[model samples]
Target: MRKIAASLAVLVATTTPASAQNAVDWFGVDGLEFASPATSFRFTDLDLRDPHVFLPITIAPFPTICFDFTDNAIPTTTVSFNGNIQASYNSDSSPADGFLDASSLLWFRPLAQDGRVARVDNGGADCLAPAPTSGCAPSATAVATAYAYASFAAGTCLSSLPGTQGSPAYAPAIASPAGSCFVTAPKTFVFDNNGTPLTLIDAQIAASFNGVPATALSNGLLRGFLRESDANQIVISDPALPGGSVTLAGPAGRRQRQLFHAQRQGHAPGRERLVVLFQLQRVPGDLHRPLSAFGDHVRFTEDTR
Candidate 1:
């Protein structure tokens, strides 16, 4: 009788938990559901300042419709409002079963002609003419916007793994910047991961003010990087130049360049966390300007964080 009781106890301990409601239930809340949730992130974004203030070339460098003078000049650009962001989490007795969704709106304006820096008259300008005020206006601006979205998920299935090893992340619908600068209707970038990890594949910016394709921009004004690890840092590999890394910090810290790495470890049972850190390049005076070199432009290295 004693032996039987002990056996029964063991069976109950193992099966009872499985029989009860699953404690690992994780539900995915759609972006629509979070339309009103209080956003909880910092926006010390310098990109929002006057585009010329963060100039890669010189101070008060007049804005131009075309970047004919130097490569570091700020292009007249703007990004519209932020779009809906949604995140969902789920946990099953499986190897992979989680997802993340995020979306937003962004826009840009590139100067192609002179007088573009100065305010224009009531009459619009053309985008191509050296003084293109006639044919579409040389200082003319192009506007493009579209609903963009992304999704991510993880689960036990072969395709549930998180990373680029599986099907590539969904591509963003490309938009062309007008020959000048233009704004589009509010758009959103939606991210969904049905049941696998979603990886960002690419990002691009155009060189010309014309409404050229995104491929052309990839070679000119675009720079991007992949989320190496949750270390809160990532390396940007600009197709036009060499690759570099970025790190975020609390207050004042030496900016670490080139030398960096990310370390991460966690499981599906709880929230995932990542931190980034770096040592600043010790210099005499502040590195207000970057060293002279093709990829050495410090503007690119300016810590936006």
Candidate 2:
């Protein structure tokens, strides 16, 4: 009987699928969007005209293992395509941890040529180990790591959770406007290489603003957005605003708005380019530190084309 029981245990453990092993029923937020040099708001050297970027995000109730479940039990809603799932966490009923996790799954991979969801299995480098050289290889540890990330991300977004949301030194929301803010900086660059008429291929913005003082004013009314229509809204005042301006990038997300234009640099339209800028402002007098002076501008531009 002991032998039979041991055999049964082995069978059960081995037969249990990876997805089922990690299943802990939960909810999260997600988003998807088109990212391209043409529509990129971030800085880059490429001139993206018809570039494309697929952004998907996930927000879990708690940190969780980052693995794809084989079961079809998961159901989700499209929060927004602008890659602003964190904003959805804020405006929606979900706990506001300003990041994405397994629960809050956002799909970043672009769709297939036929416009179907691009199916890439979650067997690559996750929150756990490095991506496999081959395809994704599921592991118990990897799933657990994904779960941890989900939990931490959810905690980071929750306003009610102390030391989790917008308060204090290490807090993302309190430290930097871009920290808790999740908006895809998409930009389009038009260049005139001394009237050579050349356009680059793509762009990206990697930013981190730190050491920002979180006073009382930076709290209450400082959460308001500076819309394009706002009197003090920063305009595309650059002498090189692209003539083929798009009316609006995408729908103004719940807590997000479209702000400015991107420009390429050169003696006429040189090799490098400048990315567009978006500002999250404080109500008049609500901030003690000048935003332009407070945080360090840690931004990077990449081409994903």
Q: lDDT for every model?
A: 0.17, 0.18
Off by over 4 Å in 1: 1-172, 175-204, 207-221, 230-305
Question: What value of lDDT does candidate 1 attain over all alpha carbons?
Answer: 0.17
Instruction: Mark the 10 consecutive residues where model 2 has the least summed lDDT.
Output: 5-14
Top candidate on lDDT is 2
Residues 24-99, candidate 2: write the lDDT tens digits.
1223322122221110011001111110111112367754322211111122532221122122211322222221
Off by over 4 Å in 2: 1-51, 55-274, 277-280, 286-305
Error of 1 at 241 (Å): 38
**Residue 219's lDDT in candidate 2:** 14
